[model samples]
Target: MEPKTISTARTARYISLGEPGADIQHVFFCLHGESQALADFAAQLVNFDTPERLLVLPEALSRYTMPAGPAGAPLTVASWFAADSLLPDLADLTAYLDELAAEVLAHCPAGVPVTVLGYGSGAAAACRWLAGGRTHYDRLLLYAPVFPPSIDRRATLVGLPDRPITLISTTTEAFTTEAVGAGLLQDLQDVGLSAQHRYVSEGPLTLAALGTVGK
Candidate 1:
């Protein structure tokens, strides 16, 4: 017997604010982090809700029982990929995200600025998709981006130098420690892409306080 592969459509869960009729000056694409729920994560960003801005939150396609729980009933959450199977999963995801983004753009007027922001694991997914030279947006905002160690910088870094990327990190967060954060910036520089690094006062990962990036 042989394994099989299937191609089909899957529901891409998402939420949006500041519809087409308002004075929308900017369109934002935000990817929620691992174990984060779409509705809850989107709720925190409601402050970005304004007449001049439109925000989109695309939910992760995969869900699982979270690990390292408090030794009781497990909690359910979503994630972008599973290490056991990533590339193939993301291939399907990137296609869906591209289509979704295109549809979002279709409703907006011409020449409106676009920004894509992702937190933690979400940042990794967004970067992986953009790595293929799609040029979907004017700017990319990554808060503590976590790229897989297996990622080939040569391929991922191609055609991205032109995109303005702001890498935000906090004063404290193991994932965004000095060494890891510095290395990421250095890696970008090595590939001819210079990133702006900003350190927030101190807190958990959140995009609401960052204000409108790429403005």
Candidate 2:
């Protein structure tokens, strides 16, 4: 199958991975962190080893550069939602996700298990996607996510009933010292979501652990 492309004037990009004709029983859609591109975690799929059978989709957003970076340095970055600067809104992201879901459905057969994985701000985007009701996924993996102040955790919890979610954080001393991370874990659990929090010594999200959950 030929590779398909999606582009916008804002500079967002999405790419599909794995064998085209293989039996695709699982699908993984990853949302990248702040100031980071999809390329950062694209290679990490090898650690999962399930990419060959799972259709992986990575999406990039359009963002502006910060003048504070350096003297007159123009930086271009991707973001799912606006942070400090005025960029894309949640509606833009929701539309993109709708298109993405349609594309994934068109590429694969029915009854395929789908997983949505988000890191940092991507986590926020994933949560918003789940709240929007555009698509239904089997699992949601969050890696050191930073929640936005505007999001109402209670309101977002309405339609998501007992969805399986995994929260993976760094085990480094620095992260442990910050109680905020632990607080987020508690908050997620308090909302009646089937959530798991794991401290990773050092490694990206892997499929080995996720596969066990799927089974």
Misplaced by over 4 Å in model 2 are: 1-11, 19-22, 49-51, 64-76, 83-88, 173-180, 209-211
What local distance difference test score does each model get?
Answer: 0.73, 0.65
Q: What clash count goes with each model?
A: 0, 0
Per-residue lDDT of 1 in model 1: 80
Stretches of candidate 1 off by over 4 Å are: 1-3, 65-76, 133-135, 159-161, 174-180, 202-215
- Model 1 residue 2 CA deviation (Å) reads 6.8
lDDT of predicted model 2 = 0.65
Candidate 1 lDDT, tens digit per residue, 1-215?
A: 86578888787778888786336788988888778877667665766776788988888888777665577556556888877577776786688688888887878887788888877778778887777534368888877677665555446666464788888776665564532467778878888897788776444434544644624
Local accuracy of candidate 2 as per-residue lDDT tens digits, 1-215: 86454545454477567644337777777787777645556665556545445545556556656454456545545766655432236667777787877676666767677788877777877787777757878888877777666666455655464678888777665333322257667677677665777666545556545545544
Clashing pairs in 1: none
TM-score, structure 2 vs. true: 0.76
**Per-residue lDDT of 108 in model 2:** 76
